[model samples]
Target: MPRWKTNLIVLWFGQFMATSGMSMIIPFLPSYIQELGITDPDEVAIWTSIVFAGNFLTAFLFQPLWGKLGDRYGRKIMILRSGFGMSIVVALMGFATNTWQLLILRLLNGTISGYIPASTSLVSTNTPREHIGFAMGIMQSGAVAGTILGPFIGGLLANFVPFQTIFFITGGLLCIASLLVLFLVKEKFDKKKAAKTPNISVLQGFQDLRKVPQIPALFSVTFIIQFSLLSVMPLMAIFVQGMHGNSEWLAFYVGLVSSITGFSNMIASPLLGKLSDRIGSEKILFIALLGAALTSFPQAFVNNVWQLLILRFFMGIFIGGLLPSVNSLLRKFIPEGMESRAYGFNTSALALGNMLGPITGGFISGFITIPGLFIMSSVLLTFNMLWVQKTLITRKR
Candidate 1:
């Protein structure tokens, strides 16, 4: 097998383990906080938001720095750095006696986390340009598959074992992922050539990349894609409850509704990626955005769980198209040596969207209700589609 293919296969597992481990603990965070002795319902909610957002907050701030370092050193090294660092911090979360301690560890985990982005950068730089989209799509599939399974596995384990033990298991998975990358994935880095490149500040690098025009527009598309998709997530379970009525199976239904989207997304990613390789990523992105908006709009009017499930499934197919296309476009537009840094900025934009989406969704749902929030998400996606049409498609024409 080719070296790039080898890297892709190994890194796919690495991405899977990293993402699965992270997700394993996320669904149980509120219960863990309550285990730390915070009994008030409102206080539990407040701390959950704070602890959950903490990771993304620091990740947004520090992603560029890690990217800069990756460009200077090697992308493989950055992946190992993040993978191992997250392993230690997450394991230590099991030992925390209070929310403050847990929050601090979460912040540290965010500060050091960039394994997925680093892996993406490595694959993008190493894979043949023509195959970049397929590579990204495969990587995304691995991540989504992990996401789909993590909570189910975590839920099962939670029933049999303590939450703290799950954290330890999550850490072990991360460690195994880092070890796999260390032993299996290989990158050809020219130390002498990297040393000779001019050192620029992160801010300067951002400005220089923005000079390409498409970079910033692509970044905005990434932010909006994440923002629109995730804004509905916090309320999804509630929406299902309303439709299904009170029952013992509510949690199971909610989990099914959530994981179903990821299943379609995983299946669609590689197919759309190959299509993008043939038709051009710009075209794929526009159509995907339009499909996503169309699917989202109807979701507001769905009166039952099955209707909502079907819409979300279709939405996932389009959602799969968004990020891979964005990454492929970034590779086309970014300067040769700055791939890691450019991806870092894109990752930061993604993290910012992840951080804000739930907060904005929770706040907006209060005023407009969950169904109304779905309509708003559809509107935002429409605006994002038009932005792409005007900026990329029209200009290309």
Candidate 2:
């Protein structure tokens, strides 16, 4: 491989290791909660919601702070902090005696959300401008592939392995990733520019947040899509767990669904992004946002795993493109010097949804049947789509 390819791979692997560990728990949370001795429906719902929301609440609170630190120090340190912090917290997840304990660890995990943003900034900054789409697409695949692979790995592990065991495996993977980044990847900071690093300000992060007029609207668009996807997300394991199958099947089905989505997404995101280069990110984003909204409704109505997987597969096509498009558009808005900080703000918005998606999904799932949660997700997403239509897609800049 060429030097750039080698660097990208190291960063990609690091991101994959970090993100995959975090994602493994998503489909297995309900099962983990079940092991905690909460059997009652209402209590399960509450505990699940708490576990789901804990990550987001922390992520939202801490993302901007991490973003500022990354700006002053370096992207390299931020990535290291996130990986090592998460490795510790996630490994401790195996020790949780109850839902509250697990929630605490997940909250701690959320505080380290800068890994993805930092990695993305590194790619966007270093990549030859012309090959950015292909490069980012390749880099992003690790996260998407991890999401796809995590549930399956998590599910299979959960069968004979304890829910706590999942943590050790994920923690090990992440630690390996962190080590790779520290020793193998090099950060070539501009020493000439370092002396003048601006005032170490979180406030300046906001200036880039506003430097582009469309970001606020674009941010909302992203939140809606993620919110829709996650609304049904929390209940996947719960739904599968209740079916007549054993734990092995739970791993198979949950992993199957997530894997298929990831597999399809891996193909679709870059294709959509490349197409966006031809049409426009605005058009692809708006249309795909609507596609995700429409796709969400059917997932709620499906009766079995097969049906759900089919819907999720198609949903991946629309879902995969949103993040890349969001990033590609930001590359347009961000001040030349502030790619990492700008992504930090954009990431905060997505992290808001990721953090909130589960909590909110848990809440909806607690009150409603698993399928009903999809309707709620679809409704919220539809509102976001309509909001985009009203505020952005149609408006002339």
CA deviation > 4 Å runs, candidate 1: 39-43, 244-250
Mind giving the per-residue lDDT tens digits that candidate 2 earns over 46-155? 67767876777788778778767666677788888988888888899899998778888888888876788888887777666665665666666777777666777777
lDDT of each: 0.83, 0.75
TM-score of structure candidate 2: 0.91
Q: After superposition on all CA atoms, what RMSD does each candidate show versus the true structure?
A: 2.1, 2.4
Error of 1 at 309 (Å): 2.6
lDDT of 2 at 95: 94
Compute each candidate's TM-score over C-alphas. Answer: 0.93, 0.91
Q: Per-residue CA lDDT of candidate 1, range 212-252, in tens?
A: 99999999998998788777664565678789986755655
In candidate 2, what residue range of length 10 has the lowest lDDT sum? 239-248
